[model samples]
Each structure stands twice: as C-alpha cells, then as structure tokens.
Target: MTTLFYRKIYAMKTADSTEFYVVRHGQTAANLQARIQGQQDTLLDETGELQVNCLAEFLKDAKFDIVYVSDLKRTRATAAAIMQYHPDTPVFFTPELREWHLGALEGRSFAELNAAYPLLMQQIRQSSFDAAPPEGESMLQFQERINRFMEKIASEHPNQKILLVTHGGVLQRIFNLAVGVVGSGNLRPLCHNASLSVFQRRNAQWQLAVWNNTSFMHLTSANDTITL
Candidate 1:
C-alpha cells in the first residue's frame, strides 16, 4: 500500500463559495479485467474495498453538507465508506449520475474492440463525444442529461459543500463542463480510482480547483485506470 498526505480540499468553507468534492469510485472488477462496466452495476472488488478506507479517512472530517451518488454499486460502496464517518450526512442516489451507457461495448475490452469494430473504434478514438456506441446514447444526449443534473443541484443546494460519488465517465462530463472544454481529440487527464476533483462556481463561472487527484491512492494501487 502507498501512503499520501492529503490537504483538505477546502481547508475552510466560506458562505459564498459553493464547493463540490467530486469523486470517481474505487477500482472495480471490470477495471482490472479491462472491460467496460458502463451502466452495468458492479460492486467494489477486493482492492476497491481497501481503497475505500483510504478515501474515507481523507474525507472523514470534511463534514460535507450532503452526499450524492449514482445508483450503482461501485459508487455506492465508495459513498458508504464516507458515510461511516459522517453517519449523519444525507446520502442519496440518482440514475442520471451513472456511467455513460456503453451499449454493445459493455464488457468488451479496448484491444478486442479495436480489432472487431475498427470503424466504430475509430469514431470512439476520434473523441466523438457526440457519437454513441451501438445501442448507446450519444455524447450529446449524455451531456444534456449531465447539464440538467448540475443545474438542479446548484439550484437546490446553493452555497453548500457537496460530495458526489459517481463513475469516471460522468466525472469526465462534469470535468468538461467545469472547464468549458469543447471539441474532440483533446488531451485530458485520466480519472483514477478513489480519486477526487474539486470545483467551485463564482459569478456563474466554474473553476476547477483540482483534477484527477489520486493523493489518497498512496494507500492503494496508483495504476488502476478508472477510464471514461
């Protein structure tokens, strides 16, 4: 196990700053297998379980005002660890925050995907955020859904510290939204298991305080790629 010293995301919360502690869930069985989990629910694997302990220890004292997670086992497991410390914190799930449905590609690996469906794979490789896999929703559809979710949260829980436990795919969308990132085929950091990203909105502008943070991963494998 690796060890990392973490600083509080928001050392001190202010009345005007709305802070979000957005986290991608820990490692999963699918991740180890190099398969796409998509919206298919899977619980945390053995390593993921230990990763949760490190995550919880890092966040136990943030005292988030509320917690939100996608209605998926991996994320739920991570959120559960935090709840053990913040026993009184309210935690809930929403389907919209789940992973981007990978459709027919679910369970398939990138290596086979490249060989089996070269054209489709090309589209994916091109960063076709608006393109969808067979039987999947397009990136446009996914982004719109995420936008609505963000709006609802900001409106409902203004000026509060919030914890969002969700998939790496959704986290990508949230990160893109946060950075006004547009277009395809751009370089973006990989989201890691049990990683955290911090965001704040001021004057209607979103600012990324952190990104793809695996500071806590010092407790677990640093190479587990929670791919989007």
Candidate 2:
C-alpha cells in the first residue's frame, strides 16, 4: 500500500520508435514462500492462473505485432493466456529472457541463503554487482543479457508494438535503465506478478510509459526475493 515515484523521462514520439508492453509472469508457490525462483521453471499457482486470466482479458484488444516470451514455464504459461487473444501474432520463446540464474541459491528462501552461504549473502548485502553466487550470474551479467536482448528487439522492430512476457528481474533492470537508477538504496518500481509495464524506445532512447500496473487483476500480488 506504499506509493513510489520514479523520475519520468519524456521524449517526442518518432516514426522509428518501438512500443514495448512487458509483463511479469504470475505468482507461483515459490513466490508465495519467498523462495528464489531464478530460472527454476515453476508453475503458476491458482492465484497466478486467475491473475493471468484477468490480464489476458484486459489486453485482448492490444494491437501487438509480435510477442516474445521467456522460455521458463511461468512466463510461457502467462504468455499462453494472453496469446489466446492474439492467435496469429508471432511468438518467440527465448532463453535470453530467462530470470537471473541464481545457481546454488535457487529454491532457497532468503533466510535460508543467509544461513547457508554467509559469504554470498554478505556480497549481496554489500551490493556487489560483479559478484555471483556459486554457478550463477552476477548482477552485471544479468543486466548485460537484458541489454543485448532489448537492443536486438529495438533494432529489429521499429514502429511496431511488441509484447514481452518475462521475469521480474528483467523488468526491474529495464526500469533502472530507463530512469538512470544506479547503486543501491533507491526505490525500485514494484513488480507485481502478472503486472504490465510499458516502455518505448525512440531514436535508441528508452522511455518508460507505464509500470507495475496490476489494476486489471484487482488483487494484491505476492512478492519474492528473486523478483524484488
């Protein structure tokens, strides 16, 4: 029930811009338990199913030219719900959009990770963007992956509407990129499960249009450490 406001960036609409509608996958049992999903391919729980069904109906009339989804089950399932309304749109499932690889931290709660991996927990506490968990990606690596995917899409789909179904980590990173947020302690936009965030890339610049929109679901969402 707290309200957070990020610095908004405004730009003139151009013919070369691409409109992006980004959706985070719905709630999962892991999310409810505060467990780290991190590419674990968890399925949607009942609440998640209902959330997506509502979201699907809300976006049924959007004129998206193409759809891109993370290959993870949660995102795929969410996208499937929405895609039923856009049956002919081209949908591409790619691992490039997967959540941050959490490695040994996967499936463990934050409390459990603090107990099991003190050093890793300390690194995270210190906001070590370059530090990675055992067998996982660093924050920097995750950001780079998102950057590459975004650049590819912006380059390839100018003047087109895109529907991107992916993880909250990706959406969080995109929010940071758009608003020039750096370091730690700054408030990040809340990424509710099954929420929709909109962005536009015009002349190679990213502008955030909407964020953390869950009005269609008509319900508060669960949060997890992995998703922020």
Best by lDDT: 2
Clash list (residue pairs), candidate 2: none
Off by over 4 Å in 1: 1-8, 219-228
Backbone clashes for every candidate come to 1, 0
If scored against the real structure, what TM-score would every candidate get?
A: 0.88, 0.86
**Tens-digit lDDT track for model 2 on 89-167?**
9999999999989898999998999898887777665545755888899977877798889989889988988899999
What tens-digit string does per-residue lDDT give for candidate 1 at 149-199?
A: 886787788889989999877877887778887676433457778878888
- The TM-score between candidate 2 and the true structure equals 0.86
RMSD of each: 3.7, 4.5
Instruction: Tell me, by TM-score, which candidate is best.
Output: 1
Query: Which 10-residue window in model 2 sums to the lowest lDDT?
Result: 1-10
Give stretches of model 2 more than 4 Å off.
Answer: 1-14, 122-127, 182-187, 219-228
